[model samples]
Target chain A: MDADLHPERGMFLHRLNPVAKLLVFSCFILAATLYLDVAVPLTFLVLAWLMGWLGARISPFALLRRLSPVLAAAVGLTVFNTLFYGGPREHLILTLGPLSIWREGLQIGGSIGLRILCVASYSVLYMWTTEPSRLVASLMQQARMPYRLAYAVLAAYRFLPILQRELGHIQAAQQVRSAHRRQRGSWLRRITHYGIPLLVSGIRQAERLAIAMDARGFGALPTRTHYVRTHMRPLDYIFTATGLAACALVLFALGELGLLRSFLAGVAESLAGAPQ
Target chain B: MAQERLDLGLARWTTREIIVMAVISVALGLIFMAYGVLYLALVPLLGQVGIMLLLGFYYLTGILVPYIVRRPGAALVSSFLAAFTELLAGSPFGIAAVWAGLAQGAGAEVAFALRGWRDYRLPVLMGAAVLSGVFGYVYEYFLLSYAVLEPTVQLGLFLVRIPSAIVLAGWLGKVLGDGLARTGVLRGLAITRSAS
Candidate 1:
């Protein structure tokens, strides 16, 4: 899956251990969830974008273009919250028959929207920086994940493009066999029929892979030597420290803005609510 | 060794089972990419009112992996890997996609664990799917801000999505599992005597 993306060479993120990058990404998202206020998350979003621009070596304009679909989701969810959340009807900004949008609804919607933008960037950046082989290798060397599982995962990661190609072949075969009836059915038919042939081919290939790996003495040892050692270097620690300090700074800022409990409670309460 | 391997109670993942997990996840990951296009088109059109309509497409790896692999933690790895696949394939949901995967994986993992990882029957598997739906639903509830909606609207969304889960991930997952089983594709791999 990391086959297509080539991170700019010698960039700070590309040099960081894949595990460090993943940890930073995970911590960023987890911390971003702490606030219901827009500023905190929106700040995080801008910070993430800046990290992409400055550290990951991505162009800001191109990054935004790539993230536009995610931004669209933020817009969709925000619109939904504004219209249907329906808080204190008197604060209504607009009304269409039974549908109403309130000021509070907009605020709440915007917070979620900002969170969406803030959260999605973590994955984008992580995927951008970390190669899949490096990720699995890091998991093995740093986290002490069993090499059996790690190499198996690497092998599986290589299966993605093959599966995609096989899927195209299956559809083409089906098209030749049933050209007239193909377009008439639901996507369910197309997907379901497509899944079987792909799966069948997939299982066959998997069995062969398992045998090949075993024959080559894969997973024979509890641990194995690494050709590319993945460890946290000084720069990785700097990246991690910078991420931690940034998180602390955001929380303190949220506290200083005095929008602590009520901000998050509103969201938690909304989620915790169920039909009486 | 074969007998021990066949026992689902043994949480140990063999090379074969790992490959199976990876294979299914990669294939489904491609499907997820396809599904993402359909979802992005529909989400804006339906807005919040139909957000749950896509519920079925989510949480499937949670169901499919455990049934096929019959290992403890298989569901968790499957869902997570599948989510990772979607993320790699450029899912717009991004990190929340991983969040949903983690939550659903944990949920389905619990369901299978309750059966001691020994049960892959249709009922047991479908039950796991529904549980995964419940977990996936809760993640979306906050992540998508359904929590901020009116109580009635929230209930309406929740009610519709659970059944949609029943149809899409639950029923549809079972259909695929059974189809694969009947072809003798999974006969020696899974301990179960009959795919049906």
Candidate 2:
């Protein structure tokens, strides 16, 4: 799955254990969720983008292009919140005919939108740097996932592209066979027709592979030796420390500005004051 | 005594079963990517509540895999893997996708567990799908700040999701599983033994 279209380029994040990266990035995402203010998550989003550019060696243009879909989602969310917001309209931001944007709605929407983007940036950065095999290896060694399940994931990961190609083939075959029919019917029918063939071929190939693997004594023992190790170096700890410090720094700055507000608290307040 | 023995029997996972579940997840992961695209396109026209109509797509792996594999953890493992696959496939939601997967999978697993890992009837499958919908909704309620929305809109979102779960994940999963069973590809699996 990590076809590495944009190769790691021997960047800093690439050297850390994927698990360590997962841990650090998760903190940033968790922080993104807790705060209701736009600046906190926006800061995190900028920091994530900087990490992608400086540490991960991802080009700025490429990052934007790759994240274009997220941009759309953020924009959609902002627009939805700005328009349908049922909050007090005391601080109106705009009035484009029947559609009016209020300050409260805009703040809430912008915060959530930036929050989504911030989360996606960290996730994309992690996936871009980490290799699938190393991730599975790390999960097994560090996370203590069973070797059997981990190997199954690796095998299935290897089959993804093959299954995609088979799906294309099935769609083509079904289209050719049904060219005579006038009505294509509902989307459900189309899925079942194509889904059955794709699943059958996939299961058959999986069974054959499973048999081959078992014959080789794939899971003969409870524990297996790792061919590739994903060790957490001292640098990984330092990197995690840096990420935590950055999060704390942002929160402290926001707190000093009196802008740090818990999103859950705000929601609870609104619900409490809402009409029954 | 019989129940304890049955629990022991169902707990073990064979290599074939694990591989098959993984394969099914990868396929469904691809389908999920398609649904993500369709979802973004429709969100503008349908708004938030209408988009719940597609939430069922997310639960397919959870419901279908358990019904076919009839294993205790099949739903949870398969759905989690499917979500992981989607994340790897560049899902915009990223890590949250896996969390949602875990939540949905656990909800579906509860339904199967209630049946003692035995029944795969349509009703049981539908029950599983509905539970998955409910679980997913609770997650989104906090994550997306659904609580801030109007009570009516929230209710509408919850109401629309149930039918979507029923038709898309539950009914559709059973249909696909039955079709695959007829093709004889599922010859060695538990589904075949139970059906015969």
Candidate 3:
């Protein structure tokens, strides 16, 4: 919600076409998916983070702060994989209950966690740098998406903040009414008491918004003048092409290194190579 | 004078109503997002907990939002709002949230759409649940499950997920909605009885 986190100017990444970025990002994900190598994925993740710092001009610490939840989840996943999803590798790390903690499982889990982190980081970078309106515009202009559908999606995006504000107001009122009631009730009871009014109000608001849009001539025109236009600059093409090339090269290198086969074999080989 | 009063009462900014609803939606969204994060985080510790938790959140949103708003897109908006909250909260699921939100929203919307935008009875709510559950199953099968397991196991898991979403999440949502209506908060909204 902070405007500073998504600044209006001076971010190089923001200037590129959103559709291009989306394509490039998808390529990266696809390339990452083709192989199971942690190195390639980790490298990509690092590169993304660096791009966020250099291209978006965001502080690394601020970016990391935003990414803390993802990091925690990744760590949790790694731990879980290490303990429970033991692979067929002969290298045993530990044992618990019926599950044998193998080196391969841990390695595979760590690789998976890294892959997720990489993908997520790149996506976060895209979203943080690009304004939703510009992104929608790029989609329409560059990708030739139907204007009507694009507009509808944009309208929905625009309404999101208003809806958030409305939802906040609803919760406060419910808390006040329930203040006199004992707080010792079960979680289910409390949720029921509070959830009803909010739901009713949200529906009412949506209805009003629908009416308001209709009244204002939204969706009335099949074609409308562009309030915002997105043009694909030379840099956009360069960025897209370069990013895709890099992603392809990484995939090729990963395959050549035999890490791809190891990755596809599941947790078995990953754990075997973990300690080394 | 009476006409003027009626217009004013109906059309005026009722800050109290707006504030109350806004707060509830945001709070519920935050809770759902948190649960989603926990579910994803605990996937290794608890197999399939992430899917179940996500389904539970969707079910709750579908039931609660429609019960209160009693209008078109309420369920859809609620489902998406919950997803948005998760994204804002920095979900580990990343951009998958976008697709998941779309699918979940559509599921809840289909139920309301089927009733011709008129009914909000228990059966209607159940219909919404079933629709949402089925959608969730299809979504997981293609998007998440396919990458991890065999076709048979994936299909079986999908079956498990659907009923769990319907019975656990869907039923709970309906019960919660009804209970709240009984408390008189939903006095303004029209209430319909179940045909059964």
Candidate 4:
């Protein structure tokens, strides 16, 4: 819940329309997955850290801590692909017993690692900066999302924690009934006996909620007014254009300039055909 | 006009359906949160085959929603909304969680579409569930570029997921649907209406 987006209303990034930020960030991640080239995404990963402090007003240490899973996943992915999923065992780097790590494996694996880092950094920054309500408001205001669907989703978002608490209460009550006293098949037994009743009650609550919503004429109008309006400021346009242009120049266009794929491919080819 | 629209499939969601889907999504998002924890912990073991391991468990919304609602595109919308729930609740992967929701939901939708969105037979549910797994992995494979991996390894990844999908999305969906129907909790749903 803490990471779900906080609307503190500070900094240039926070002021930008959530829709613009979401769009730009999504475009950036899309570009990363497209290339699968190492240097490109790696550069963006570094840039994301810098942007955290300069643009988004996020601390560097906080950014790093939040993005640690991505870093771990990158390391784990590199190891897995390099050791397990890579090419025809060409250009051996290390060998243990029957397993051999090839140079091509390293190239592809490292590419995936860098891609993860780049995408994760962008995503972490975006989610950290944008508030969830702002996101929904923008969707409805900008994207013309139906108020009924959007509000329902928002109300449901508010309900998740309540449901978690309800689940906890149910578990405690069942534990008092000695549900966990029997160690054998406790979890499986609990899921059926506990989960169903919980869901049944949850649905009943939602049904009642729908009735309340109707009583208020929740979706009687085609266009409803917002108490918290989201307007696209000059800052939103500037941030989006600048962010996208930077990503394209650094991640995609620069990769084309260096011909990164062919260079890696050539290095791989040489290693594969290298003489013993 | 309202009842006619519902029958003709012109209307996608009624207010009641929206509430129901939202509620279902929150409940299932809890399940997703648990899986996400397991995933973060077991990534080493999951390795390249990480996606298939999630096939069976993740798409339960796809099956349950469509089975109960029987509305056009209910499966896809349900899965997506469920995923959005995970996002609002705070997903580690951020926006990719929503993209994943779309991918998995579409997977389940494919199976139901093949049956012309009419059948809720055991085989139909099972097929949808398994395909949801296939589609999820397929989406990630392309999205993450798994084409570079060995063909045999790719095949193995694809194969291991089928059984889980069958159990979770396919069989469990059917079982739970039957149970809910017996409890008369699914009263006024399209499936129940069609049956009675």
Best by lDDT, which number?
A: 2
What is candidate 3's CA lDDT for residue A111?
A: 69
Per-residue lDDT tens digits for candidate 1, residues A1-276, read: 123133335687777888777777777776666555667677788888888889877876776787788788789878877777633334658878977667777877787787887777777777776776667667677666656655666777688778779878987888889853865778777666878888988988998999898898876655456655566678879988988888888778778988553445665565565222
Cα lDDT of model 3 by residue, A1-276, tens digit:
112223246678877777788788767755554444567667787777788888888776776777787787668656654554433555888877776767666665676667667767766776787676777666666666545444444544445566567657766766777652675677666665555554555445544655565677654544555657666678988998899888778767867877664434543443353232
lDDT of 4 by residue, B1-196 (tens): 0111112241356777788777877788768877777776687776657655655778889998888877668788788888776666556576777788889889889889888988888888888888788788877775666666666766777887888788877877776666666666656767577762
Residue A275 of model 2: what lDDT?
A: 35
lDDT of 4 by residue, A150-213 (tens): 7788877777777778888888887898867673574445556666766766777777888899
Winner on TM-score between 3 and 4 is 4
For this target, which candidate reaches the highest DockQ against the unseen true structure? 1
Candidates, ranked, TM-score: 2, 1, 4, 3
Contacts from the true interface found in each model, as a fraction, amount to 0.52, 0.46, 0.10, 0.35
The alpha-carbon lDDT assigned to residue B29 of candidate 4 equals: 79
Best by TM-score: 2
Backbone collisions counted per model: 0, 0, 25, 0
Error of 1 at A115 (Å): 1.4
Order of candidate numbers by lDDT, starting with the best: 2, 1, 4, 3
> Which whole-number lDDT from 0 to 100 does residue A160 have in model 3?
52
Tell me which of candidates 1 and 2 scores higher on DockQ: 1
A130-239: candidate 2 lDDT, tens digit per residue = 87777777777776666777778888888878887988888787678774263368887777777888899999999999999989997676556666766667898899
Cα lDDT tens digits for candidate 2, B1-196? 0011112232378889989998899788878888788888888788877888887878999988988888888888888989888777777676888889999998999999998988899999999999999898888776777655656777888999999999999999899998999999888888888952
Native-referenced Cα lDDT, model 1: 0.73
Question: Which ranges of candidate 2 are over 4 A from the true structure?
Answer: A1-9, A87-89, A94-100, A179-183, A274-276, B1-11
